[model samples]
Target: MHKQFSDVDTVRAELLQNLVDDGETVTNLGSITRLEVVSRIEEVTKKIISSLSMEEAPVLTLKSRSRWSNVRFSKLVGLLLTMGGTVSTLRSDCPSTVMKFALILKALSAIYKLVQSDSYVTKRDIYYNDPQLFGSQKTLDTIVDDISCLLKVPRRSLHVCASTKGLISGDLCYLEEDGTRVDCTSTVVPVSSSVSGIINIVSSAKFVLVIEKDATFQRLVDDEFCINFYPCIIITGKGVPDVNSRLMVKKLWETLHIPVFALMDADPHGIEIMCIYKYGSISMAFEAPTLTVSSMLWLGLLPSDIESLGLPQDALIPLTVADERKLNNIKKRPYMSFHPAWEKEMELMLRWKQKAEIESLVSIAPHFLTRVYLHNKLSYGGWI
Candidate 1:
């Protein structure tokens, strides 16, 4: 492995050199191009088709890794993992395994067809492709996920897409590969899974602010947060993030080389979501190099702020048994241990036995979040 650089400027410069261009078949994200991916799919599909035509035993091979076995924590990169093993179709000897193998092939064929047509389809689209065979959306989603893991590529690279569950507002414009011109500064738009495939970006934003909830995002947008103060981008995962939002945030931070801060409820769930954005999720740990935003800071509704800012007592909620369990679970994770500030915050929350939402800020003042909280945090550099 090569030496990893902690310098943000140097990393950004290296990533920028790999951005895609017209007819460019190379990238630092993955040297593999769309056309190259298509060819690979065709080659795999042709081999299977020929085997069946010759009355030979049809064999398939998938190289994948298990999260439980493969994932590990890294101080610099968060959860990281490597893929290994070539699983053969011969493993499908059992009645149950046979059905599972068939499902995998069906998904592979669907992906191959998608590449052949030079188009893309969401997981929902794939689910509906063979509703009877695929059954529920989860079933199809799992199969597609398995394929990505097996092929050692992102779902996007395979043309299997997901819906946009995040919203964005900022001083940014970009051209999509399909010729869709997106001017984020014009209006709030959902950050689609297709964001990674965008042709180019033109932005003058100084930084990006990622809010945990859509309501908070809307509040910031309503207040013209960017227009009033700094020319910056504001984004929301709407809850837990979908891939597009995460990818877009990662892309912006890498390309623009700007500060990225997260605002969330002062609770375990919110902290987990924030961690996912900064350090890639455990399930997709292998993709951390491209997906995670290591520089993102926690700009928040901190546990200390509940008292420091004198928020209404009524706004605080007692932690449920479930919430406590979640916090305990998070505390056990390796990454959490590495961040003493985060550990201190979790300790504060556990001591209080209560959690508060960002919306609770309104109890102190209707415009408090945008006016007082965020302004003070950004101005005073109050982030961890």
Candidate 2:
């Protein structure tokens, strides 16, 4: 067995001292309790009722969360809601707004019951209650986020959770809300049930690796990568991470105070996904303080590595039209101005006219990623 990196604690701790996450301040991560959610629900309900009593069309002024115009970048907190940000109005009397306005109230009614009952439901389950009204799961997703932003509460606080889309493994143990003990040291598992309800997190891991793709994560599992590293936690959001995974990553960084590194493809989408984990997304900027881990370290296969490692010409994928467009947009992001290393790596990929996946490391050897490349990078300080 490849137990070359058998020592997890000492080496991991050493890395902790050497590796740093520049903008990781999760101490101020915000959470509201079930009682608070109920309180806010009651307050909002009363205002609507008061408007109805006065025969006035009830109007809701919500923070515009799904737009770039509403966000501001902060070196301290990453992307966040701008001060006195852009607002959108939803009026019950307006023909264009009435359907959505009704939908929001119905969803709120379900949420109120869930909080009071001390239970939670997935966004899918909520959507199913009246699918025709919601029109699509995407619409319900929007409504849930809109309500969260309007109330300035974590979406989980609304007694709603997204369908978990991430996976985890490696040296860590914790209790779920139902008192289910989860141990990730030996096997891969879903992130956790009701992540907000998890408690007593305990880990001896040296660092956390946020993987970009599930296929690569599964490859690591088959190679027993974590077993070799002993106490290193590895996770994947599958692709663009959902809220539960983001919260778990933020929580782990705050609690463990370990170095968090992102292992991703040398593609533009992969880079954007890592940025979402580190800098927060423009669509959900209002929740950046709790949802982002700005101190994220870049692990490989970086764009520069594709050339340096000499991956096969065929393995190097040509950038698609969409890829080029996304890369251009990524270069224009606010953080790009500060990260010249990122700029240099991107330029290399553009000049090469190719992108590479973590899977391409297989060309070097079947176990090159686990036995050679990763072992070397992780054992030593080989990350950006």
List the candidates' TM-scores in order: 0.85, 0.89
Colliding residue pairs in candidate 1: none
Native RMSD of candidate 1 (Å): 5.6
**lDDT (10s digit) by residue, model 2, range 1-384:** 111222234423432332233332222244666777788789899999999999999988888776777776765457876656678889999999988899999999999999899787899999998888899999999999999877767787787878888999988999998899999888888987477678999998888889999999999899888887446899999999988899889878877878888999999989999999988998788677767777787888789888788899988899988998899899998888878889888988888789999999999899999898888887776577
Among all candidates shown, the one with the greatest TM-score: 2
- The lDDT of each candidate is 0.77, 0.82
How well does model 2 score by local distance difference test? 0.82
lDDT tens readout by residue for model 1, 1-384:
111224555544434332222122223256356676667667766876788798775565653444434566655455655334234353345664677778888888888878778678889987876799977998887787777655556778888788788999989898886889999885898786677668688898878888999989999899998888678899998889888889899888777877889999999999999989988776676566567787778889889888898877899999989999999888887787668888888889999999999999999899988888888888877688
Locate the minimum summed-lDDT window of 10 residues in model 2: 1-10
In lDDT terms, which candidate is top? 2
